[model samples]
Target: MYKSLRTFSFLFGYLPVAAMNLKKFQAQKANLSKQEYDALIHTEPQKWAKGIMARTKSRVETSGLDYLPDGPALLVANHEGNFDIPVLLSEIPKPFGFISKKEVKKLPVIPVYMEDMNCVFLDRTDRKSAYKSIADTVGKLKDGHSILIFPEGTRSKGEGVTDFKSGFIRIAKDAGVPIVPIAIHGTSEIMEKNSNQIRPGHVTIRVLEPFSAEEIEKLDAKELIEKVKTTIETEVQSMAQRKADLQ
Candidate 1:
């Protein structure tokens, strides 16, 4: 009963904070141009995420950021917790965009805000729509925008990454951008797979080296997917082992 109350209190507390942030975002939206709006949206979220991570008593470890070069690249990471996206978006020092589900477009005000911030949403159930979305994402990359993709399509419920889907590789190839594999750990434990109550925990993000577009161009889609999956698995395992050792 106490735990349930705590959860309820947390949700109530977070909702208002989210609303205020959104309100502020809406008020400021018209003052910035398209580029400025994208920049602020990306940077402000990182600040908000860092504050959230700090409040939740989480810590992040990163590596291989130097591997990201100037201009555009595809960032692929393992999704474990719902919090992972905000965590990554908070710290990654690049003007980046995200590939999100089309269903989010139905979200009141948020989708309009996302559109203003230049997020690309894909409709999974419609083949033609998905291709059109992919083409739109590739165009954004061509316009020199980096992007984050969880090739696993959804969050993993436990240790180790699920088999990667090939769609991201297709996106990277079509966009002519390099793929950077990022491995994240501990976020699931912070909020768990199905729960919403945020717990104080540490989350580590391991940014592996970027694989150049030129490098993967010769490899088939199947081989490229395996390579990124292996890299993320290795780093995520290392983080898990490190957490276990500390315990």
Candidate 2:
């Protein structure tokens, strides 16, 4: 009961302040390029996220970043917790964007920040709008902004990952950007699906090697998708298993 109340209060109290921040964000977004916007977001995100992580008592250990491409690449990961998105934004060093659900655009301040980061929003229920989102996302990628996409589209609690959605592959192909497979584990332990409580926990994010766009083009799209999906799942499961073993 206390946890639920805490979550509700947080939402209600933060909304109005967040709205004001959104207006400030909109006034600034027009003057920035995708990279510039990313820089702007990160300027204070680290300090802010550090404080939040401290409050939530969340710990994140990242591996394989050394293997990631230094250039623009599509970043794909499994969404697990409500906190995972912010965790990624606060942790990942690259100037990246996210392909988010349209509902997120309705948020008070977050959508403005997302837009500043060159994030694209898709309405899954509207097929046409979704396609337009894909097109716009590809354009952003082409303009030199790497994007983070949750191929599973929604949080899947702490269970195993769901099937990869193919729409992201089309955007990657269209943009001719490399794909970076990221496997995140233990996020749901911090904030589970359908719940807002921030439980104390640790998470792992593993950055896999870049799979080149040119490499994907030679093979059938279906085959390429399968390969990437298998690789990411395998990595995520391995990390999860390792974490369990340690515990």
Candidate 3:
């Protein structure tokens, strides 16, 4: 209970401070272009994400970063917990944003940062809006900003990965970019599995080799989705087994 409260306090306290920083940034940089402003402001959230992991006594070990090619690419990963986004934001070497739910746009300070990061908001219930969001994401990708999508659409919360929704595949295909599969394990143990109480844990992020645009084009959409899904699921299971062995 105490740990949960501590985590809650930290999260709530950080918001107002983040909002103040955003205000200051906007006030002092009136002439900056949109891209320039986004690039400058993005560092704050990256730093904050790292700080959150550190404060919670969590360790994230990553591998296969070399597989991420230069230039804009689609990063597809399974959703595990709230920490999944933070972990990726802190660890991914390139500057990128996410395809988040449209409801996030209604949030206070967070929406400001997300918008600055060039995140696409999907309205799941609105097919037309979701398609528009994907088109917008493709535009962002073509503009050289990487985007991460949890193709699983929702968090498994440590129940193992669910079937991925294939709609996001269109972004990479339309943008003529590679699709990089990422596998994450152990994040749920930190604050999710134990009822949102922050705790010490080890998480692993594995970046699988990417499928080039040509490769993606050669495969049917369903095959491409299954390939990525299988790749991540295999790695996740391996990581989970390794963690278990360590214990």
Candidate 4:
């Protein structure tokens, strides 16, 4: 209970002030390229997220960053916990946005930051809006900003990865970009599994090699999705087993 309260207090206390500063920065740098603007806006939020993870005593280890190429690409990962976003933002060297649920756009302070990062919001219940969101994401990718998508559509709560929703493949294909598969393990153990209370834990994020546009085009959509899904799941299960062995 104390940890939850502390986490909430820290987030609520810091965000509004941070949002104000970001808005000033945005207005002053209105002419910056989208990528430049996003990197600038995300600087503080990334720092804040890393601080929060530290406060919770969570350790994040990332691998295979060298495999991420320059320019635009689609980052697809399994959904495991609420901490996944922060962990990625804090650790991943690239400055990128995400495909977030539309409801997140309604949250205080956060929406501003996401917008600054060029994030696309999807309302799954509304097919029209969802499709529009996907189009917007593709445009961003083509514009040279990397984007992250969970593909699982929702968190698995550490039960193990769920089957991915294949629609995001359209973004990569449409943008003529590569898809980088990422597998994240042990995130839910930090907070989601125990009623959202923050705690000490270790998280692993592994970035697999990119599937180039040429490579994606060689496979049918089903084959492509299955290939990426299998790659991520294989790594996730291996990481989970390693965590269990340490325990």
Clashing pairs in 1: 46-90
* Model 1 per-residue lDDT tens digits across residues 1-247: 3443554455345545555676777688789765565676665556656666666666777766777677788889998978877788767887677888888877545565466556799888889987887788888888777788888888785557998988888889998999988988878877774366667667787778888999878899998999999999998898888889998
lDDT of 4 by residue, 20-81 (tens): 88878779686887667767877877887887777777888899999888888899999999
Q: Which candidate has the top score in TM-score?
A: 4
Per-model TM-score, in order, reads 0.83, 0.85, 0.90, 0.95
How accurate locally, in lDDT, is each candidate? 0.77, 0.77, 0.86, 0.87
Better of 1 and 4 by TM-score: 4
How much is the lDDT of residue 13 in candidate 3? 73
Q: Which regions of candidate 4 deviate over 4 angstroms? A: none
Candidate 3 local lDDT, 21-84, one digit each (tens): 8887788567886556666677778877877777777889999999988877899999999899
Candidates sorted by TM-score, descending order? 4, 3, 2, 1
Q: Please give the clash total of every predicted structure, in order.
A: 1, 0, 0, 0
Per-candidate RMSD, Å: 3.5, 3.0, 2.3, 1.4
- Which candidate, 2 or 4, has the higher lDDT? 4
Native-to-model Cα distance after best TM-score fit, residue 127 in candidate 3, in Å: 2.2
Query: TM-score of model 3 relative to the true fold?
Result: 0.90
Per-residue error for 10 in candidate 3, Å, reads 2.5
Candidate with maximal lDDT: 4
Q: What's the lDDT for candidate 3? A: 0.86
Q: Which whole-number lDDT from 0 to 100 does residue 17 have in model 3?
A: 85
